[model samples]
Target: MIRKHDSLIHQILAREIPQYVIDERIRNILNFIKFGIESGIPANGKEDEDNNTAETSAFIRQLADDAIVLLKNENSILPLKPEENICLIGPGAVERRTTGGGSASLNSYYHTSVADALKKKLGHDVPFAMGSLIAKNLHDLGEVVTNPKGKGFDVKVYKESFDVPEEKRTLLENYSIDVSNLLLFDYDPKGCENSTYYMQLEGDLTPDKTGEYSFREQCLGTAQLFIDGKLVIDDKTKQGLSSGIFASPISSPQIVNVKLNAGQKYHIKVEFGSGMTFTARKDSAALVTDSASILNFGYIFHKTDEEYIEEAVELAKKSDKVILCVGTSLDYESEGFDRSEMKLPGNQEELVSAVLKVNKNVIIVNQSGTPVSLPWIDNVPAFMQAWFNGMEAGNAIADVLYGDVNPSGKLPLSYPKRVEDNPAFLTFKSNNGQCVYGEDVFAGWKFYEKRKIAPLFPFGFGLSYTDFTIDNIATKLDGENLEATVDVTNTGKVTGKEVVQLYVVPPKTTTAVDRPLKELKGFAKVELKAGEKKTVKIEVPYKYAASYFDVDANQWHAEKGEYGVLVGDSSSSEKFLESTFTLEKDELWSGL
Candidate 1:
């Protein structure tokens, strides 16, 4: 409010906006605030509550069922029988990560972890283990902190990290907050004008289960963890930049192992510094004004990496098949920070590798918003990409695994074999304060097609428990749009959905500007039963396919050229049918 009001005041002083207009806006705001205060507060339900009704709930489940994409299925190992004994392995197995970290996180009415969902569906015990520790951040530690008043932590912001005497140190804000995760940017503390700021968080931690505990710190800047007055994890000097959107200035978790008994109390003090200096790649993006200041600090019940690996392998040996839930976590990939690399974080690589050696019937169910390097792709028989499906994360996985839902999701983005194969690899990050998009227009499949690079998984690639074939493809010009119609036949034994992708392959043009070899023009998702055939039509604007941005003219002009329509299930699908279409004359468009 202050910031907006200050801006308005500046505008009024500068006479940028009329005084009457500003007055009316201020009056409207005041009236709304008065009305809200007088009318009391409305009942604010949880985010999931809006869709908690029966119809909406079913639609949500279907949405989840449809969004899941099957990337690989070697020897037809998917759609596991419900009666089969399955061992759920990996940290994501029991954890209900229905959402990502930061602002994308959600508070739901109920959440069913994969372990719980599997148990419900199988109607028996589903053996599970923490194959790896994908530690929940400080904010997710809701019930562990025990203070005198209630469950919360005490926080104090200071102007400096050290050298200030306790009595002389100025207090910025000392308050009790419910969550451990703190975004200092939102707080906007006073008296800290420099790039650096410090914080001290005090809390009481009581272990519910007696076992070896591990504490770690993950922050954009630097931090130290002190348990019972003994320094455990210190990441003060370990500051670096990362490509991940949410986990920037990435520093590996500096963990410390400690043993504690159930119900035992420990005093925890976390000291933090908000800014760090680091050398980034010459092409790294500069720190924008809206860059995040995050603290994903917390500790979790710990087991040795070797211990986790052994237990998962043992579980895999006992079961008929293993549902190895693996992928990047919120800390590895999120909204603000781009991931530094494509590899899975921490000891996950070792865990999966060990599990694969003993179990050939391993089904890797990966959950991520984007691609992660799968070094063991060939070793696993089946793989599915369950990108952050909402509230029913576990139930959705069970639905697909138990053959209740046929996977029909298509990859929205291409999966690179390695980070180096990415079109923007050499110029992905910005240099100094400038970012150069060297591979403009030729992103994703276009880049791969142009460079003759084979992606691990091409864009629009997905498999189902059934089969589909695109036949009798036809294209016609209707008014200002090009209509491409194709007959989609489900020849397999089960009912499933398929996303029909339409790509426009332009002919050789005399224009000097660079252009992609082919571009996605339209797409449609159609469901069909076994032996059922449906004709699906996708419409693409004639100008969209025929036009290219003209820099000199500062407009988009449709070149007088011939183009062909490629219809298929995926970008790299060999089953595509081609048909040509032409534009009669040149056309120009301005102002999107």
Candidate 2:
């Protein structure tokens, strides 16, 4: 190892970095630490005051409620009737996936699952089934395992490895953790920050149904699982490469099947050593190493995909209405890696198809942060996009389904009818460690409109329970900004919100440069009561609304020509109310 003084990189950094800059950074860090300590903040982030208050929670619920987009609602199937016999089916229904995984993941104070929320609203339990398994890894055992006191898990930390004798090992700390998906990237125990450590977790599992249970273990370090004091999985010696927590290259989960009995308590123990104990060769892509470790283990009762689908179909056949909650969870659509395909994980498509055949009164609610292929789009009468909404996700979704809240959220991005329709379909992945921007300016709604390809749903597209009309459009130049105003009336019998989207169509240029047919410039959302009219005004800088970057001039240029302004609810041209404005002379400028 090279000393700091002898290292060339360190020498250069010292020479280039100013002393005051370094001092300022250190001072800021010290001040932050002082504030945290003085404020009596808990290191574990479990303080009572840290939890969301009633008001904050309500606000979060409202945001989630408004952000849900009603993509498709035919025959007014939404706002489910109270008397409808509803059945909730899918893996997402039972999973409390409030957020995505990786850095975006967090341990919420509490969260309600869709199944529980629906049950509460109905005043009784509804027919439910796990139609398919979409988890890329084993399911978390946090909800299944408990300690002697009926708690999550008992954890014991040590400075020595498992190879050391029990009496010789030095105990470092002991605590209780509520979850099995442990990401210890920021874990810094007293006196153990720079040292290798080991942990032992003990828990008891009682299954409700007897079956062959499958347990899986994956770790950034080395780990072993024991059930009833028998070694079930040993990931310490041999390991396989896969992306783990923090995008680190770690072992692929090792699974073992054990026959378990119903209502019979089983003793569970796990021994884990820090990354220093890992014997695998260092991978170039691995981010975490000796400084931290991650351990994710889970278990589930073994069942075939066909059996699960059959059960859901049976429930759908008997119910008067079905809410099939299907989509990718954190396991499939997290930050670590890009999804290889656009289709739903596992046999979810099959489950949706099967359910639709049995019952036509079905509503599909997809909870995903990104787009997923909907093969049954034409078949389903109602569909919704519920992105990963934090703690109040279930409550918000319940509100929309029962008509307590009107969904006004519009699609932020266009959904391609097929993956092939995407602008970057041919060059989406990296080639020879270099990615080509093949699509150029044609992206999202721009690409769809330019190619005249109809998307599954256009950007800014959303359906409301009530109807709205847009007319009397006008525009004027306020200095360098163009202000567009339009009269909106809630024509339906109920109150609703409408988004007024403004798009600018630039004049056809004789130059070789090509541009999008039309581009969205500004938008405003307006809420109105039945038979009420409201004028909404949207303003955009003239350059921002009508200019394109001129490569030769190295600046944005607004050509001296007529520019058309289109106002509508979505990107589809047929729905737009058109008007025109002209610039007397060309304008060129740069910088914010």
Candidate 3:
């Protein structure tokens, strides 16, 4: 390949480029090729083997259990009793989103959904309802569709356009695909790698319930869905832009609803054109090129968001307690794109409000990697942040919900009540190809503290099954190092863990430079038994504890002042144990 593109490479690199740089680049590429040759590829079957072991599973479960943050436990509704009739509700309850999308996505060997895990622990199935549809696109048809051999679609490739008659089209290859979400960027047909092609996917979709079924189609190129020889959705000519695959501007998803009977099979056919046949103007922002095509086809028994919420409310009314599992998944939260808003997707907020009206014993468990605004937060009795925690997410969440594991996680960042409260709200997006960092150093809790704006939940805030107290705060300074020690005790009957946070409050500056009210310098997590006290010491260099980058001086400056050391479980000011230590002189340094 290098030899083939030799002239083109030379044409690009011959001018203005240093010879040594080009030689180094070539050497690096050769070394990478050599490494690949020496390593060799694994055996076909071994390459995809499941690598998870029993110990690793247990460890993962433990990590998930500890990472859960109990944001609110009003009236102590947590540590749920086993006898309570618990009802699991929402899309997250049934869907196993073990990871995010894009590069972070993976095909785990096995995963247990929250509904399944809870059912197993209760030794019986609980009343469950999908309160809302959080998925941006339609659900895949893999589970409901099948072919003569088994579950899957029979796919065929042709070196012709969809406009051509089936009899006149030249067939290139045919295969069976079990998944409807197909990414064929690297797919090369026997004789059609460099030519335009089309694909046809055929399967039998058997419905489990009689209802209005909705079918949705989205693709990188043009596509159309046909049910029993009837064209249902035409996504070819009337294409709009959408953030679907790779956060690219692909053809917007088109949907069509059809009535179907329970236990009855319907013929499903999808005609897909290659990326080259895309009708819409090619978008440079699209991560996928026109080498191949991408297709996502899905169908589901239709139900209105209101109807789903009503069903969930009915279930919640009868149950002694409710576990409202809700949050963004890979579809709405991923690497390729940023969420348009901070609210939960779909009518989830309405679902939460409706459920809360009927059940006060609801424990809302949100699973997401980032913070989402909760409008009904004040009314809920209990809330927990259970992030997308790998394969053992369900099992670990069940453990925490049932008191088998006490949550010890703290909020790493502040949760703003609204998107408008965010520090970067004004200049968050690009303005004519340039983005301004308007917030500057006032990011995270720093902005909230400096601006005197109270966040929904401050940084380092978390609730434990047991209570803890931090007292007897003392500070000492030795040279450039400052150490703060505090006594943390578990006051409640249950054993729990406490994170002792040490925040440094810089003295009022004499110059024009502004500083935050306080900044977290160091922290220590301590496990304490009931009535047990432990002296946790957190030490930090004075420069790191109270330094700000002096951009003009090209150095970090620690102002000479009496720095206040505040020790607390959270960043909230009211919970702190304060003390003071003087730096005596200003210090400026560059390298770390």
Candidate 4:
């Protein structure tokens, strides 16, 4: 870092420069950067000799315990007895996917696996079976490439597509690049900021088996793969962002299956697009960064599907409670791409069905950033949604399973029974290069309620080991706000927390503008001991209960009408208490 400029006032004494040239903003920025470098903030990691200190680890694990959501529990089947026979069955049990794939992945200094967590909690060795392998059958292109240096495929960057004439094409760069997996990130092509560019990767593939070779492609913008002059993977469509923050692909890969001879040399070519004609894709709201295009490609095969299913069934029959950890990985569901389907990947559905036949005491723990279709949902007795819980995922889960903690986290969004049932289903896909939000106000829970479509699980739904009841709802007008109070009582035999949600149901307006059935106004999370009672008072501004976005006037206006204050645990659940309030005048307001 540069030393502070030898006193500015002293510089004027030597007449080196004029005083008017001083810029306070530039001076402040330089000072800040210099301070950061001199302070050694980047080297602060050295302060902690052991990254996973007991104190810090316990804090993070508690955070996970607080965040995990329990979607379903029938007859209090959770909080398993310490003496119960427990056997882990599934690839997820031992796979130890602490975080989803892609950029979110971390080399956690200390991480716990689900199998290990269970054993630690129970103080006994946990038996685990590799019921069905969650293996990707694709051949690693790194090992197959013919580069003498043993790096990556030969790559060529072009200003035009492969269809362009070779003589007219402008070559950018050509180099040998190697990849362990198919993800491509952080390649900066000069003069290509917020513009479209094409890339061709030349490689050779030698299959290990003489069977139908299938390839899948998932891209941020668009890409196509050709195998020996024939197009095997065509992903030219404008893709949606799978993740909002990371700009992941919203769609899964489209498969192309063909028979090929084993150990035969096959030429591979890939064509990628970075931008879509200056337009945004409809499936995603996030913008695609010109930074790098993540092109993930892989092959698929399941030679021993029957054998795997049989082994899982045998284990399910022997176990008293089956904790089926099934869901998508970061590779399947990430920030860049939205999933093409809601169904679980590979043969997970088949495995679940076969296991259900032999055992009814299955507790399905579905893990994903988003919802997935559960065709076997009805067959299971208990279900939980354990989102990406970081390094303490297993330990946090064991806390809920063993009664160390009660699950209180609610669903932030509705879980549709099928992807087709989503309100934006018909218009969710990008048309050309744009997505239209035609659903308007009817998004998420509002759409389901408006269309009378029942979701598998409604927004704000969660189960606790102990039960709670709400009563004694009362309301009053306090200046420009409505203050509502409700009494929440824990009636069960154990201590737990209950989220009291306050919903506002506006009266049918005399005007023609249609309104949603109800909107979530506020909520309060109350914790209590068994038989404990507490009053939670929530404040809802009059604007929240009476206002609507006036598109014609470009402002939010409130109507003078009667509004019903409905309180409940979730959107679809029965209202615990209902009270009405009246707005004396129509009010218009804006700004947050």
Candidate 5:
């Protein structure tokens, strides 16, 4: 709560600001903070929670309940009134941490894995039993290699220093690694941006300047290294980070050293590759990069299709309703990692299909950064998407499922049927040393309009248990900002929440780029009791609303034209209130 400007502690330290007022506000905020933290978990007797993440021990139970979709609730076994004899099977039935990964990945303070949560929820009412582990031991490989220039890229020889460029000051002038205080050592020369270099230690080394340097003999850089006279590593040559985004040695602790040359200074050299990465060593040679590095750290630990599927089947058979949790994990899609194939992993699809066959009533939940192929969509009765939610995932998911909170999330990207259908697939994994943005700037839903391909699940697709209706949409445009007022009512018997979404469709003109027929600009989550009615306000931007970059204009641009204001539960439904208006003169700034 203490923004830079409102930091009372800062103000008091910088200037002798009064302490009385600051002390009082501290008490108030601290009290709230304390309550918030305590409330996340079940309060011994508190009414509700107010923490950074809406989590509590009950959160696990809540998520399991809300997330557990009733794909098949035959004969009222669920809400498990007289909950029948259950045979909960599957290793996963007991522990399900989460789906998806990356920066969004978080560790819950405490978790009730699917099995633990179910057992806690159903207890003796449903007999809990364990199934076989999906996988006994799983490992994924990750590798990185560095070698001497011109000697070819191989897992041998590592040169520690690099050659300095004649034209520029030595790049190593002031580089420092914090190994210890008062013992800073100089690194090799500078590196070129967007360039790659390779270096090699021909073989073993006799310290050139050894009196004071901490020299140890260890095998590395295709050669043995010796500082002064100590051996740090032995027998191995070159080594580097293997696999994953953490390719640097900071995350890799192992190294190898080669045989040592008894009495000579090992000279370092560098070899540079144009338009690639750069490496340099010992003011003598350029560094060389290993072949492509494979990063599968996350996938290494994932359960196999057979393992996960087997687990799911067992879990499904034991419950009144089978909540089969599955989705695209981090390894499936990433920013730098190019996907080799667009189809769902063979085992993943097989797993879901197999689970569906065993459980007549099955709920399929998917997690992905972007959309993935869902060939089993038609087989599953219910679908829930829990995107990369933050630390509050366990509790948040629980809230929505138990009717404590309503599901109001909507997809922001289109889910394609196949990868081959994408416009970027042709040049995506290119080796020409260049990335060709062949599709210009039109991406996501916009590209679909250009290619005339319908997505398996359109952007803005999400379902709600309760029904809602949109009535009377009125548009109020003020140059760049557009405000909309619409009346919404819960038409179903149960209470629910709905997202008020706004979309803009630019006119098809010579200058207008092929854009999505409609794009999500802004949205609001609104809740209503059954038969309850309320008018909600939403806003949209004109030219300033272009969030996806457009390169041609060197600026973000939205064309001045009539725009649509849509209010509905999802993109596919026609059950909405909409109106149109034109931007005749005023223009929103180029947010490019």
Candidate 6:
């Protein structure tokens, strides 16, 4: 009431105002503004404190909940009842790769490993199982069978050493591992190509321990994976993650297969001679000694989906419900390149398929930035969309699964049924070492709508265990500002949170860019019980609804025409009520 009167007073005071009225209004506004600043708002100091997106830990929980997509649940196999004596199978069930390679990585104090998490949830008496991964077992074979032609593969004295390249697969030439003997880090600071550099091995490794070893220069060709005297992978194969920026980790867990007695000493040497030298990468090293990090991060490294299924089926049989936490590994997903396909990498799809054959009921939790083709989504009962939900992943998922929190996250991107459906798919492959993001801001949902191609899962397409109803889409215009209000109610048995979203559509003549039917302007996450309801008011300036940025004009132009306001759940399909509003050239911006 006072705010409206004050605005009126300001407009009416173009000529003058009573001295007493001016002083009283100024003092009230200042006092209210001061109180708001000191109240610990979300944004401050140039930050919009009114952005309540992450006002509390609920945002973390919402992100965690929304990212967990239950891919498969055949029978009532999930939310496993508390029964002891179950086994934890597969390499992943023990150690999880919370974060994959590249920029989306963060180091943290503690991470909840599935083993540790389950152990904490279930007591010490729970039985655990470890299965032989065919892929990893084959890796074991490669290391065990190869002896440099003289060390004797069957020698009882097992002394192993491996060189992890400093620059991912820096030695990746023609698809063959370009390994360097020098234990040094190599990175092209200037993006140099085929450059020569030198580094020396300074670690405790010696050459004499492996008997008399001599340098053998073999013509190694392209192949990410190479075996004794044979090239298993090469340039023609598209397993290109081994290229420049990937720095894919080698499957050399065999590094720990052998033992080195501390008292013994030996000298080892590998003469790089006069060849190109890249840095050697050290495996996940510890900050100190034998102290294990609270977080267990490493890949299960299954090459094919069949391999994943074989490992997963054994796990499903052992436990009451199958918590098949699966997704693409670093090799299949990373920066510099989009994925070749959108299907769940490896045997995840196949794993989900096969798991249903044995135990009809299973719960699939996935982690990825995009949607994967769930050929069998119709067969599954429960799903989760666990999209790289940072350090809070395991805790948040566990919290929701155990009914500790209500899932309130809305989708930020759309998921196509296949990689082919995406607009960038035609020209997406890495070309000339550059995968240009020419699509500009019109990516994901915007492009999909523009091209008339549909996404398998639309943006803001998150599912909640509860339901919400949005009513009364009304707008009020005061000068150049608009206030949007909608009534939201939780009309479900369970308590849940609702993401009240607001979207704005500019007039056709305002701008000529690829505009979405509506762009997300504002959203509010509110918690409510089964019979609870509340009116959420979201305010927007004409600038927010106006079309800005003209590539030709290099200036913002707002046409005096009609605009549309949409409020809904998903960016594409949802029951949202909309109303038409207007903007004028002069009303688009407020110099004030």
Best by TM-score: 2
Model 2 RMSD, rounded to 1 decimal: 3.8
| Candidate 3 structure, TM-score to reference | 0.84
Q: Please give the lDDT score for candidate 5.
A: 0.47
C-alpha TM-scores of all predictions: 0.78, 0.90, 0.84, 0.69, 0.57, 0.61
Off by over 4 Å in 2: 1-51, 148-150, 185-190, 193-195, 242-247, 283-292, 510-512, 552-554
Residues 1-592, candidate 6: write the lDDT tens digits: 1223444557567646567786897899999989988897645345333533444445654566655643333352444555633444343444334565444554433345455656666665344333323221122121112233332121110011124444432332211111221111233223224333222211122222322212211111111222222333232122121122333222112111122233343222221211122122223221111111110001122234454456657666766555555565443455534566776643456666777776655555665666678787677676667666655566665665555565666667777777777767766766887877767767778888777887767777666666789998898676757778889999977888877777888776644566566687777777888989999888776666665565566555565788888888768745778887875444333332
lDDT string, candidate 5, 1-592, tens digits: 1233435457787776778877898899999879978777554454333442544545544444333222222333222232444443333333333544333444444334444444444554334323222211121111111233322122211122223444442232222111100100111224522222233222222333323222212111222222334434322333432223322211122232333343455432212112122121221111112222111110122233465456657766666555554544444554434556655543556666776677766554444456567777776665566553433344444344344555655667677888877768777755776878776656776687666788776666666666788888888777657777888889987777777777755554415455566666677777799999999987766554433345665665555556666666556556766777665643334534
lDDT of 3 by residue, 132-187 (tens): 99775567776458988777888889988778898998999887777677766656
Q: Provide backbone clash counts, one per model.
A: 12, 0, 0, 22, 69, 41
The lDDT per prediction is 0.77, 0.85, 0.83, 0.75, 0.47, 0.50
lDDT per residue for candidate 1 within 242-299, as digits (tens), equals 5333223455545567898898888988777764322232222333322235566666
- Candidate 5 TM-score, true structure as reference: 0.57
Model 5 bad stretches (over 4 Å): 1-112, 124-320, 330-339, 342-346, 395-404, 508-513, 545-561, 586-592
| RMSD for each of the candidates | 6.8, 3.8, 4.6, 11.8, 16.9, 16.6
Per-residue lDDT of 1-592 in model 2, one digit per residue for the tens?
Answer: 1212334346557687567776897799999999988998676785565457898898888899889999999999999988987899999898877998777687787787898888888899888999998875567776668986677888889987888997898888887777888877656567664547899999998899999988888887899999999999999878877765455667777988899999999999999987766666375335543455778898877888999999999999999889999888887776666777899989999999999999998899999988899988999999999989888899888999998888899999998889999898999998998999988999888998888898999898999899999999999889989999999999988888999999999886525478888989999999999999999999999889978888989998888888999999988835688888888888788975
Cα RMSD for candidate 6?
A: 16.6
Candidate closest to the true structure, highest lDDT:
2
Report lDDT (Cα) of residue 358, candidate 4. Answer: 87
